[model samples]
Target: MTVTLKDFYADWCGPCKTQDPILEDIQEDWGDRFQVEKVNVDEEQDVANEYQVRSLPTLIVENDDGVVERFVGVTQREDIEGALESAGA
Candidate 1:
């Protein structure tokens, strides 16, 4: 069961800008263990809608077991890591 972290954001979103590097660092730390994909809301509205994203920087973590968790706004690295741990990564 592969886990996926979908990052929903837009270029003009200030908070999303702040969130980018954090997710990047997390992605690097997790390596292949985490399938992190950046979803630009402006470019992928349907995908955002699929996850019911109502804000920028919304992260939807999903896997074969289903949606493990969701985080909105500026998320802490520890929290995201904890979700990874919960996903058995």
Candidate 2:
């Protein structure tokens, strides 16, 4: 199945900045195993609203079956990895 990591963040959000490196590392490790879509809330309010993202850094893991995991704020590396693994990434 296709797995996707939807990262909802704004440029000015501090926690979002902190989450960036972690996501980058995950991308480096996972490569094409999954896809990461970064949504800038400031520029993409519609998309953010569609996801009902009420926080600065919201991470949503989805597969072909739909959303499997959702996290708010600055999430840990292992937590994200676990989510991806569960989603069949």
**lDDT by candidate, in order shown:** 0.87, 0.96
* Clash pairs (backbone) in predicted model 2: none
Mark the regions of model 2 whose C-alpha exceeds 4 Å error after superposition.
none
What is candidate 2's lDDT per residue for 1-89, written digit by digit as tens?
Answer: 99999999988899999999999999999999999999999999999999999997999999999999999999999999999999999
Clashes of each: 0, 0
Which candidate number would show the highest lDDT if scored against the true structure? 2
- In terms of lDDT, the poorest run of 10 residues in model 2 is 8-17
lDDT of 1 by residue, 43-84 (tens): 999988888999878988878898898999999989988888
* Per-model TM against the reference: 0.93, 0.97
Candidate 1 backbone collisions, by pair: none
In candidate 1, stretches whose alpha carbon ends up further than 4 angstroms from where it belongs are none
